[model samples]
Target: MTAINFAVIGYGGMGSYHIHNIMPNENERIHVVGTYDISGERQKISSQHKHKIYHSLEEVLTDETIEAVLIATPNDSHKDLAIQALKVGKHVVCEKPVTMNVEELDEVLKVAKETGQTFMVHQNRRWDPDFLITRELYKKQQIGELFQIESRVQGANGIPGDWRHELKHGGGMLLDWGVHLLDQLLFLVDSRIEKVSADLSYILGDEVDNGFITYIIFENGIRAIIEVGTTNYTKLPRWYLKGTQGTAVIQDWDLSGEMIVDSGKKNIQAPKPIQAGVGLTKTMAPPSEEATETVALPKITAEYDTFYKNFYKVVREQAEPVVKNEEVRQVMVLIEEIFKAAKR
Candidate 1:
């Protein structure tokens, strides 16, 4: 297979991380030919990593050898870079929140169709282990029929850096972390959202929201709560899912969690009422030890295809993209609705 040459724009946090996380080996069918960053300092960093740095976007785009462009710049720049790359007939792999707004994404899509290039968003969270575990549970029905799912990510550091705090740059937790959580929920449920309600917090007083909570109701009778926060000192469980016959909790990124399911056989003895501050109540009591079975989370099968591999396959017309453009457009539309609901 001929190795596809690629260029990366933006050499900041995510851009540099992509170098290490997604770049294929030298023998693979793809390679990062070079990188472009506005900051000389960031360019220097990329040089230190042994990558050639292009002086400008035109340099990268004009290169006939480059088959693809990875746009890892700020959210606001995603649409422009992707459109330019697509216009030049290069396949594009753009970062999430694909564009600041749905309208911008539509423009990018138009260029992609005109150019006949493969365009896909880097919604990498679809392959995240925790989400994969949750999806596995949902598919396997390990805890019976899933009815409620809550996904959250919180930090006390407040909004990070300048671009995220400025509205013009598309700064906000919703577009940041909220996109991943919502995408995961939609990927797992396979249902059209019946309705959505949201509340975005500006407690930190930035131009953009510091946090948000979005409630989504699905056509399959599943309800999901997706949240992202920057001021949360005491965080909630990373994931809490409840089903008709059991419950699952994942505490953090370490994948620490368990599943407890009803054992079908009833407990031989009734549970004693536990004392509360004001009264004793059987309803609030914990289930007897014998009533439920505790089980380790099932091992999740990993689909280890790199973003480039899928892009190559899509370009070859051999397979459909795992990160489909239509799915990405839906997420962008959902994000717009989330922002609107929060404003209301």
Candidate 2:
């Protein structure tokens, strides 16, 4: 099989990562032929690495040999870049928050349909090990009928990049990290969202939010609280889930956490009340050791290599894409709802 030739449209952090890290030679299915960046400095860096650097987007688009374009440009540029690539008969792999808004995404989708070119969004968080393990437990009912999930990422560092702090470029934690957590929740719940409430934080005095907290209620009775924080000196668990029989906590990216569940044994002894600050209470006592069991988190065995491989099949064999445009559009719609909820 012939390898599909791809060109990177923006040589920023993620763009470079895709070109260098993800474009594996062993795959023998995809190859990075060249790249384009508006920044001359970034182009120089790419040239230093021996990558063919296209002088402009037009150059990459007009190159007939480049069958696909991986767009990692600013959020505001995604729609135009994607549409241009599709118009020129090039398939497109757009970065997350595929567009600034759903309307923008709709326009790109329409053009993609007209051109009959494959268009896929890079919702890469679906492949994260923490998310994957949580998904597996949710599916298996590891804690028995999961009803609530809390997912978050916190840091003391302020917004890292320049463009990320500006509103015009679609900079904000909601559009940035929130998109990933919300997308992961949507991917796992398997139900439509019935309601949403959100609060966007602007503590840094920037026009855009530094972070946010969103509450989503799924039609299947699952409640998800997703948050992104940049001012946290101390952090909370990366994930906390509650179900009928037990609770699970994933402390951080290292996946350090545990699950404690009620033992199935019958006639378990009730907990004896311990000394309290002032008053004695049997209602707030920890369960007896015999009544519950604590265990290490389940091993994570999820694979993340399928994103590019599936894209290869979609482009080469006309197979269904793993990251479908329709799914991406749904996330955009949800993002709009989140914005509105935050406004309220």
Candidate 3:
């Protein structure tokens, strides 16, 4: 099989990750041609890793051997780099928050459509196991319909690196981790969004937000709260979802959590009143011990290829992109509205 030669741009954290970890996978359809970066240190590192390093973007784009380019640069540069790559007849795999805003994304997509080049965004978190389990619970109603979802990612680290702390480079939690959570929610919910409310966090005094909390309401009555925090000394559950007949909690990336589901047992005894701060009441007391049952989080598997492998299929076999441009555009649209809502 002839592999599609891929050249990586940026060679920074994510770019370097692509070159070292992602592109060289068992997918025989993808081949790494080389990498390009402005930083001399990164170039030396790339060369040390036995990769051909291009000094300029032009060198990579002009090279006939490279059929596709992965844009892992700063967010501000994605639009221009993607447009240029597509203009040069190279299919593009862009990192998330595809553009600073949807308008810039539109410009890049316009060129892609006109040039007939394949364009896709990373949005890799859709494959995350936590999210997959949640999706299964939501669809299968193993517990019942998920009526409310509280998703969060908290860390003690203020923010990662310098560029992410600035506003101009699209550095912020909203654009950073926020896009992933938003994309997952949008993908999980089939209903249209009825309303969105958000507030960005800048407690760290950086030009960009250190974190944010967004509440979304869907037409089908799904209420979701998506949040990110970089200052939490203690973190909450990564996912907290409430369904009609059960409640699920995912503590963290380890996927340690459980679902408390209705026991469906008749003649359950009522909870005895417990001591309170000053008052005695049973209204706020926990349900009887027999009222609910604890079960393991559902195990789920996706019948889709990994992002790089899917890119190969899309570019080589004319298969639909696992992460489509339109879906990325929708995520961008939600991001725009989120920023707008924060302003209000």
lDDT of each: 0.88, 0.90, 0.91
What value of lDDT does candidate 2 attain over all alpha carbons? 0.90
Candidate 2: stretches off by over 4 Å: none
Clashing pairs in 3: none
lDDT of 1 by residue, 1-344 (tens): 67778888998999888778776654576788899999999999899989988999999999998998889999999988998889888988899889998899999999988888988898988888888899999999999999999999999999998799989999999999988887888788888999999999999888899999999999989999998989989989999999998999999988999999987885356778999888998888887888889999878866545666777778776588888888888888899999889788
Using lDDT, rank the candidates from best to worst. 3, 2, 1
Candidate 2 TM-score, true structure as reference: 0.97
Query: For candidate 3, lDDT tens digit of each residue in 166-264?
Result: 889999999999999999999999889999999998898998999999999999999999999999999999999999999999999899999999999
Of models 1 and 3, which has the larger TM-score? 3
Estimate TM-scores for all models. Answer: 0.97, 0.97, 0.97
